[model samples]
Target: MYKLGYRNNNCIGCVKGGAGYWNKIRVDFPEVFKQRCKQSRAIGARLVRDSNGNRIFLDELSPDAGKYPDEPDFQCGFMCEIISKENNL
Candidate 1:
């Protein structure tokens, strides 16, 4: 099971769930987030974001477009960092 938390900034509310909860920690503590991302990537899982600004989980990426887990090292940290920074986290 995952835990959830609410973070308010600029009148917007952010709900944390699963790894998403880590975002709060990531803001309060960045080094930890980097380490976690590194570890997750090493294990072949990745965090991604969609056009809707939602985080996407990837265990593997396939050119065939079939359902499969995406690799964690597949540039998740980079995207996460970008989003976090852009969003002023």
Candidate 2:
């Protein structure tokens, strides 16, 4: 992702992200964000959750939703190299 100007390796629009992350995607990669929103609706699945425990579509996140919590960095080779054989089972 850093190669494409994105600082993290998270998916284009990771489902685990919070409002702050979604909002950032809206500003930085509007097209990709839009695609995820549309696809999510078509499949009846959403990546965001609102304060009321309701699903908040990617397109509906508020501008100042919240701040992204700091996290440690990890690397993945796209191979399950980081996982253990026991965990895979």
lDDT of each: 0.41, 0.67
Model 2 scores worst on lDDT over the 10 consecutive residues at: 71-80
**Candidate number of the best TM-score:** 2
User: What's model 1's overall lDDT?
Assistant: 0.41
- Number of colliding residue pairs in each model: 10, 0
What tens-digit string does per-residue lDDT give for candidate 2 at 1-89? 56554556755676656676677777788898889889888887877767676887776777777555442333444343434343662
Q: What's every prediction's RMSD, in angstroms?
A: 14.7, 6.4
lDDT of 2 at 7: 55
Query: Which parts of model 2 have CA positions greater than 4 angstroms off?
Result: 1-7, 70-89
Q: What is the TM-score of each candidate against the true structure?
A: 0.33, 0.63
What is the overall TM-score of model 1 with all chains considered together?
0.33
